[model samples]
Target: MWFKNLQIFQLKDTENFSSTDLVTKLPDHPLRECGSQDEFTFGWLPLIRNSEQWSISSDLCMLVRAGKEEKVLPTAVVREELEAKVAEIELVEGRKVGRKEKADLKEELVFSLRPKAFAKRSDIWAYIDLKAKLLVLNSTNAGMTEQLFKLLQTTLGSFPMVPLQATVSPSSIMTDWLVKNDVPASLETGDEVEIQDASEDRAKIRFKSLEPLSEDVTRHLEQGMSVKNLALRWTDKMSFVLNDDLTLKKVKFDDTLKDNAFNDSQGGALSDMDANFALMSLTVRDFFESYKVWFEIQDED
Candidate 1:
C-alpha cells in the first residue's frame, strides 16, 4: 500500500541489514491477540495481503508491517456502571463510599468488563531503502513510531537509526522559500500553507485553497511569521505537506504513477503488488535524492 504520510529516519549500520535477517527474526514477534486483561498488544504482521511473507523486497527496498491490537472500553459506559455499583453499595450500607473503595470498585468493574470490550486492530507499514540508507514509516506520530522502532530493535537484536534532521531547520528553509518565491525548481508550491509567529505568542495562521504567495501571506511574513508547514508538489509525481519537523503529511502520488504501475503488472495479484511497490520505492528514492541536498543530510561512515 502507498504511504499517506512519511516519517523519515537515517539508518546507521545499514551494511548489517538484509531481507533474510528481518525474515528470520519476524517470527519472534508475530502479532498476538490481546488477552482478557491486557490493554494492548504490539507485534509484526505479514506485509502482503494473502501471503505469509513478512518481508517484500523491490528495487532494493524492503517492506514490513507492525500490527497493534487494543481493547476498546468506552469510558462513559465504565463510569455509568461504576456509578450504579457505588450507588447500590451506599444504599445497602446507608453511607457514602470512600474514595479508596470507589477506586477499587472501578478497578474491579473494569477487569470484569475487559473480556466484553471490543478489540481493534491496526496495521502500520514501513520500508527500508537499502540504497538510500533510509527507513521510512507511514506515520507522523512520534509515540506510534517509537513503538515500531522498539519492536524492530527487539526483534532484530539491533536497529541503529535516528530521525532525519537537517542542518538548518526545515521551518527556516521553508520560510525563506516562501519569502523569496524561490522554491527549488523540481518542487512547486501548493495552495495550502501554515505560518506561525516566532515570538512567544506563538500565534498560527493557516491558509488553504488560496494562493500561498499572495499579498496576505506576504504581510504575515513581514510581520514576523514564518512557514511552519508548506504544501508541495514533487515534480508532478507526488504532493505532500512538508512540516517543520521534517515529516510529510497528506502525501498523494499522481494517477499517472499508479496507472503506469498497473500497466506494468502481470495480471497476477502478487505481480501487481510487486509492480506497485517497485514503482513507489523508486519514485521515493528519486524524490529523496532530488531534495536531500537542501536538507544537508550527512551520510554515516
Candidate 2:
C-alpha cells in the first residue's frame, strides 16, 4: 500500500554539468520531500547518468514535482558504472549503510516516478461476493452441488449444534441424496425433516437443523460484516473443528460436499477456495495459540 505513492525520477544535465557535479550538488537541491525526520536525515539523492549516453541514462532518477521552483533531487544511481562514485560519496559523507540509505539510494535511480494504483476495499469485497454467487450457478452435478451446499450450511451455520435447512423436491433425486447423505436430517412427522449430528462418535459427526437467521441478521452482515466475522460465525457453528491440527491430520470436507462444491464452483469460486480457507484457518489458529501461550506465560509465578 505504501509502495503505491512512490515516485522515481532521473536527473537531466547539460553538456557542461557532469554526473559527479550533479551528485555533489544533490544535498543542497530543494526537491527533498521526505515524509518523516528519519527520511529527511538519512535520505539521499539517487542519481542515474551514463558517460556514454547522457539523455537516456539521465532519465533513470526519481523526481517528485510538488510545485514551481522545486528543484529535482536524485535519490539513487541506476548505472552500475556509477557504483564507485556512489561508494566514494558514501565514504566522503561517512554515512552508515542501512535501510534508510537503501531506500534513499533506490529513490535516486529513476528519471520519473508516479504513485502505484491500488484497489479500494469496496471493489475487492464486491469481487469476492460476486465470485461466490457465480460458483453456485455453474455446478453441473446437482446432487454433489446440493451435498456441497448442505456441507457449507453445516460447516457454516449460525449454531454449532443446529444445521441450516433447505427443501428437496421429489423430482430432484440428486438433491434428495445430498440432503440425506451429505446433510444430516431428523424427520418430524410426514415430509418435514431437520438436520442434527449423531453423538455415537466424534469422528462420525452429522449435521443438525439450525433455526434460520432473521432478515435482520443478513442486513447487519451486509452493512459492515468482515471476512473475520464470517469465518468466526462459520467456525462457531462447526464446533471449532477447523484448525491447524485438524488441517495437518489430513482432514477434509465430506466427500459428497467436496464433490458438489468443487464440481460446481471449482471452475469459479471453489477453485481457489481451499487455499484461502487453509490460510484463514492457519492464521486464526496461530493467533489464538500465540495469545494462549502469552496468557500462560503471564500467569506464571
Candidate 3:
C-alpha cells in the first residue's frame, strides 16, 4: 500500500539538471500531507535529444497520503522558474546546445496503488473473479502469473478466517524448456540414447566474444581482471550512474573511429582510443544508470 495516492510530476524541459535545486525547494512543499511514514521521492533528468535545439525532461514522483489534497503553490511555481533558469545557464555555457523546449507536458495528479493492493489482499475469491479480466488485459507470462498467485497465497494465508479460491498455474519455464529442448519422437535419423539419472554436478562456463564487450560491466570485467571484486568495484565507480540494460539497448559501433583505427599507421595514436573510450564511457555511464536499480537488486538477491 506504500506509494498509494502518490503525486508524480514530469518536468518536460529540465531533464539534464542536477537535483540540488529541487532538493532545496522540497522543504517549501506541503510535507505534512505526505504523512510521517517512511517514503520514497526521487527525480530523473533525461537528455532526450541533442542538437542546436535540445529537448530535456525530468520525472518527479512522490509518495504521499491518500486523502491529502495536492498543493500547487508559489513554491512549485518558483521551482519551475528555477529549472528554466538553470536550463538557460546551461545553454549559455555551451553545456547544452540550444534553448530547451517543454513538450508533451502531462500531469497525472491522482494515482493509487490499487493494482499492488489487490495482489496483496486476503480475498482470493475476489482475486479469482478478476483472473479472466487479467488474462484478457494483462501481458504477464504463465511464470509471472504463478509467481503472483504464490505471492497472493502467502499474503492471504495469514488470514485463516478468509477462504481462498485462486488456482495457481504451472510455471511457463517448465513448458518452455520442454518445447525448446525436447527431441521429437518422430525423428527417423537420430540414434536411440539411453536415459540417465540427473546429477548435481555444475559446469563452469566462461563467455568470450571476438568483438569488444560493450557493456559497463563488460568494460569493468575486462579492466578489473577479478570476478570476485568486479561487482564491488563497478558499484563503487559506476553504481547510481550507469544501467546495463540501457547500455546494451542499442549496440552502435563508431565506424568512423574504426576506420581511423586502421588508417592511423603511425603506431602511437593512443589519443583517438583515449577519446573514444572517454566518450563511450560517459554516454554509457549516464544513460544506463537510469535503470541500474534492477541490476543492483539482482546482485543483492
Can you write out model 2's per-residue Cα lDDT over 90-168, one digit (the tens) per residue? 7999875676665565555432221221111100000001111111111223343343334323322311111111132
Query: TM-score, each model?
Result: 0.93, 0.15, 0.16
User: How much RMSD separates candidate 1 from the native structure?
Assistant: 1.9
lDDT of 1: 0.88
Which residue pairs in candidate 3 collide? 242-288, 242-289, 243-288, 243-289
Clash count of each predicted structure: 0, 40, 4
Error of 2 at 247 (Å): 20
Cα deviation of 169, candidate 3, in Å: 23
Off by over 4 Å in 1: 89-103, 199-201
**Per-model RMSD to reference:** 1.9, 26.4, 25.7
TM-score for candidate 3, residues paired by index: 0.16
Model 1, span 1-301: residue lDDT tens: 6789988888888878766888888978988999999988999988765578787788789988998899999999999999999999999989999999999999999999999999998888999998988899999877678889999989988899987768888888888887888899998889999999987888999999987888889789977789999999999899999999888999999999999999998987667777888889898888888668867776664
Tens digits of per-residue lDDT for model 3, 26-109: 234311322222122111111111211111111221111101112223445544755665577577876743333322111211
